[model samples]
Target: MADGETPIFPALGAMAPDFDMPASRGRQVSLASMRGRPFILYFYPKANTPGCTTEACGFQEALAALGGTGIPVIGVSRDPMKAIESFADKQGLDFPLASDVTGAVTESYGVWGEKRLYGRTYMGIERATFLIDAEGRLVRAWRNVKVPGHVAEVMQAARAAA
Candidate 1:
């Protein structure tokens, strides 16, 4: 680890950083292109991992409610498109899954930071989600998230915000 690199967190109510990254659907998705529609932006550690798959499936199961609240879900991970595509197909996840190969987007969102495993420290994406309003403001956020019932909370937040 660097001697003086401090961690950062995303500020509440701030506009999320605009990003253009590859999606599992064989195209690039930019936040700006999704203007006028609210979205649920979530970042997971990796694709096909147990927790990440559960989170993705949870969102998949709640798509109707999410969409009903006029919010669409987007999952992000530092995986290649091939891996993401397989994960989506295996989990039946309809939400768009973006690949942040360069990790720039994740770092910008403050999700990529120091992580620990068995007393070893490293850098990785922290499970997180942000509910963005149509005007591009952060309406709600969950950082270092727990997988269980997280999507449901997001759905509720979306409805309440709407």
Candidate 2:
């Protein structure tokens, strides 16, 4: 979905694509390790940018509430490991930030796609979020997400699913 193709994320109730990727703070996250626990996978266009910063901080602020409810969250972007590290440190983000440098994960999630800015068409990752149940099936998805109050919405749905 990165070049003029229609965006299509994994269907609800379908198994999420498995992945083992490097994360910030010298950590690694894999779908296999996440079995039997619900988690959030959010994709953003870049690291340390305005929108991304707001979104990441929003998640950081809500982590306490989400953690008590047993839902973990991971932020993903096509940035290099260094960038993610810097961003997390600057933003005080306590959650994992996965680097999808190859764009494989973004493509599988259908969040990487064409975009137009200033009348110039280009490829980028769409701001999207996927809520995966403990069974590894996606229960909900928010494509082209608007940052304001998005994490609250996710928390509400996650509480219900959990």
Candidate 3:
């Protein structure tokens, strides 16, 4: 989970919570609206940073292939819509980069919490991802993720679920 705390929910096969939040592209995405389509929901700490950028770009490079199979990847972050838009545009990310400005959505997913850096501690969203199947139940989850190869793994998981 986000602040290194154990996730506040049950494991896979549980119904993911229904949430509607502003996306980087200006539309709202909700679990209820996505019931019949599989999606990968990834939560990141920030936009345009090293790890976050690498993760987003990795998805950008494989978007066509993943979409060709009909699974959508949605990236969420604490940044505002403006920041997400700029990051998506500058990186040519074709996927939806959702915005969780209030961090409510992040907390709902158990991806927000207390984090410490250099002995300093604060609350922030933890970098994580969830693979929600067509039924809106989680098929897989990755917490406190490292960017490299994460996209490819999510793609594989999505394909398997599909």
Candidate 4:
């Protein structure tokens, strides 16, 4: 990836990028730990912001259904562990919310890149979601995700994949 060039989402069927980061509940999440279990890994720009909050809550609401399929959802951001923990508590989210303070995980996932908002350009995490199968292969990806009805779509895809 060149400077100022947009990062491309990892090719489908490719192994998802590896990650190991501190998360809410004083837990550490990594791709290796999640092997043999399909899971959802989503990246949002900031913690506790409106869109992020909505997305987190939506996943929380669908936890039971998701868990029924033995799939866990993990949210990732560049926010520090403290902020990520606070957001998880405030949102009543039981799933892991990992902090990628060094930006490596986000960059590896192709979610960290140039972002434009309110006519201002900046570098940040793009709102994105990826569903990885039990084998750690990327099964589905949603970039530039819109919050409304997104979880339902994920749920449907998860059912099919599981």
Candidate 5:
């Protein structure tokens, strides 16, 4: 979990890390509350950034379809609650965008790790996604995510799981 080291993610079919964090709309989202329901939990580096916005908006566009499958998407970031709320409002994102200010949830999920940009090494949240079933088992995971067509791929997997 040190900076510049690759993260060790949870194994497939294992229980995902638990989380309880503040989110947009003045709500608190938690794994316990989401029990008995499948959900998509994604981790992004920052709110309102290009890639993050694209990913969030893509999920927004597919919200209805994802809703049909009875799976809700929750976005997580290490940004503060105020920033997350602003990003959600500016993007018109209907899904919950949880703020993990303490970095505990992101660390447990193995998304907060080393990152490099423009030859500068730093620590940040990796763009990742997890599909958890009703039983809290990890059904699928995507790490080092690329933006284009990613949401469609996730949607397809969600439908299949559904």
Candidate 6:
């Protein structure tokens, strides 16, 4: 890898980067706490935005099925706690939503990068999802995600991982 080059997203079977961040449920969460259980860690750009909301609701809808299989789901973004709390309430999302305010977690996971909107380029998080197995190895990654049918796909993978 060249200088300044971000490592490519962690491949299948790679160990997930550990993170300890403030989650919306009023406590800190870390990858170590999730050990021995498969979970999905999804990153989005912001709270309450159209696409972000859609993706969040999709996960909420799938929570029952995902939980039934003993797989947990977590959503992460750079949004502050207050904003994340409001978004979760407004969207009726029951999963823990972590605030990666400093971008360390996002950067370590390689989802923070350049993005373009209306030809204006800037740094932001790329919507991505990662599935980590019971032992904390990343079993799947979905980057540059499209909202439609995404939760279903993730659920499929989670089911298989179990």
Instruction: Give the better candidate number (3 or 5) by lDDT.
Output: 5
Q: State the C-alpha lDDT per candidate.
A: 0.86, 0.91, 0.86, 0.94, 0.94, 0.93
lDDT string, candidate 5, 1-162, tens digits: 688874488888999899999899998999999999999999999998999999999999999999999999999999999899899999999999999999999999888888999999999999999999998999999999999999999999999998
Off by over 4 Å in 4: 1-7
TM-score for all models, in order of appearance: 0.92, 0.94, 0.90, 0.95, 0.95, 0.95
lDDT of 6: 0.93
lDDT of 1: 0.86
lDDT of 6 at 82: 98
Ten contiguous residues with the weakest lDDT in model 3: 1-10
Question: Model 2, range 1-162, lDDT digits (tens) per residue?
Answer: 478864377788899988889998999998898999999999999999999999999999889989898999999999999999999999888899999999999999988889999999999999999999888898899988999889889989888877
Which sections of candidate 3 miss by over 4 Å? 1-7
The collision pairs in model 1 are none
What number of clashing residue pairs does each candidate have, in the order they appear? 0, 0, 1, 0, 0, 0
Which pairs clash (backbone N, Cα, C closer than 3 Å) in model 4?
none
Evaluation by TM-score, superior candidate among 1 and 2? 2
TM-score, candidate number 6: 0.95
Per-residue C-alpha lDDT of model 4 across residues 30-99, encoded as one tens digit per residue: 9999999999999998998999999999999999999899999999999999899889999889999999
The TM-score between candidate 4 and the true structure equals: 0.95
RMSD (CA, angstroms), candidate 4: 2.5
RMSD of 6: 1.5
Q: Residue 13 CA error for candidate 6 (Å)?
A: 1.1
